[model samples]
Target: MRMTISTHDHVLIIDDHELVGTSLMLSLRSEGLRADWRGNAGGEEGILADVRRLDPGLVLLDLDLGRDRDGRMLDGVHLVAPLIDAGWRVLVLSGSSDRVRIGGALADGALAWVPKNAPLPALLRSVRAAAQGRPVMAPERRQQLIDTYHEQTTARSELRARLDKLTQREREVLAELAQGHRAQAVAERFVVSLATVRTQIRAILVKLEVSSQLEAVALYRRASGR
Candidate 1:
């Protein structure tokens, strides 16, 4: 069945390629929906400005935002959470099938992901669904999300269990270390000797079942929801 697209369902396409953005914008507008295109994400401020001005119902986002000033790939995944936080519904449209990237986008609150290679009809359907606040995901992608959630939950549970075994002093040491404190600094903060701080760090690592101080600190941050 054909999905009904409302005229008020305006969409913004953020793609690094001008041709791709123009093509998508034209196609979307042809369907009687208001559509616009921006060739780059333009960073947080720029994107937020565009969102405020256009008030798009949905953003059809390309995950690769081309290169940054540093020549690194400007990952659009970083924008998903901010866009959602700012009350924009985003639908990821990417050619890359990297599960980690896809999973990150889903976890970050993107409404759906439509492969860039998908037929225009399929893309339009996904966009319509997103505009109507209906979430959709491919079965395999859905399973991946489920598995990721379960894994994070299990890890958190295990981390909590490990933390339960920590002494009060050990937890304090971990908190300091997670904040990038050196053993010497921690010793000064706690008025303990450097040796004592190092000892606490070792104990923390053992309790957390981690190999090193860094690992212990990372686990502490994750466990503490920092």
Candidate 2:
């Protein structure tokens, strides 16, 4: 499976599985691409150290690192923001079939994503495309990204229009909810009774034209773009 790309396209693989990384490295070298492997997705701290030391032109990453001490997901989504912020090109390679996870990673700034089951030639194409600064994504995933962008745009427009329909109390409730507060917590913070908070929340939901708290929150996030 050895197929190398180019000497200049130094690649670093961040995956928890040693066998997978080894196979990938060998396959990459076979194609003339210089590839190296690391055993960890590198907890946040380790990831920083690896990035600083490797300084690779392309990074192939696996998202599911299981739970660390904090019980947080260490998937590609978490890595995307840091990698992009540091100006690194990242390609997500994972066995997971979670489209939501894939979408989140792409939204956060991954250059490409390919399922591990993809053909070797397809993987090679993605690696080369990524090295050349071209986006590589499954057709369905690409469509999902477009749909998500459109949904957010529409949600934001709706949110803005709804804001004018909200009362002062409903706006206050929405603001706190948008900050990730639960209805109960918001009730406590505002020193309002639980029933009153529930009523305000229902009003806010109506004003936002959403049926559920999650929907309202999503609309708020889309409007805020954060």
Candidate 3:
């Protein structure tokens, strides 16, 4: 059943993509709902301000907020809890298909998610449902996403613990290898003997529980979020 748009609560769209945000705002307005688009969203402060100023009942939040004027990257996962805390419902509208991030947003209290590429009508349906304080996601499906996020977090924590076991020199060698540098090049760069660099590589592999240099480099990149 299509729920009627309630008059008590407005809608706010916080997506750094200007076109998407504005289009959503305009479409919702045509549905006889009050809507606003805030493309910049600034950062945490900007988000807080928007919540306070608009006091929207539902927020369409993007998981990747892009960046601010200073080029600092902003992750929308961090904003979900705050918006929920401020008494607004959040429905994630993100381009990223990363289940971990989507689940992370849900774990942080987002009501549900709508992909950035989802049909506009479908997306708006979710927005309206959220605004009406109705469930936008099934309980089972939502729990599955949350489980995926928790599993990834556990794996990442284990990987970090292994990475922490590396000696300072081994970490340097692993970093050089990650940059596509040959062992010979790394040795020369560090003014160390080729044998010394090769030994460090072996130690890094052992500490990271990887058998090959390639695996070691891959693990380092994964842990470092590169």
- Highest-lDDT candidate: 3
How well is each residue in 90-148 modelled by candidate 3, as lDDT tens digits? 89988988899999999998888888898988887888778877898898999899999
User: How well is each residue in 110-189 modelled by candidate 2, as lDDT tens digits?
Assistant: 77678888887888888988887766866676778646755666766776777778888887888898888888998899
Q: Quick one: RMSD of model 1?
A: 6.9
Model 1 residue 58 lDDT score: 82
- Give residue 146's lDDT in candidate 1 (0 to 100): 46
Q: Each prediction's Cα lDDT score?
A: 0.80, 0.76, 0.85
Tell me each candidate's TM-score: 0.61, 0.60, 0.91
Model 2 C-alpha lDDT versus the unseen true structure: 0.76
Best-fitting candidate, measured by TM-score?
3
Using alpha carbons, what is the TM-score of model 3? 0.91
Candidate 1 is scored at a TM of 0.61
Least lDDT summed over 10 consecutive residues: which range in candidate 3?
1-10
Q: How many clashes (backbone atoms < 3 Å, residues ≥3 apart in a chain or on different chains) does model 3 have?
A: 0
Whole-structure CA lDDT of model 1: 0.80
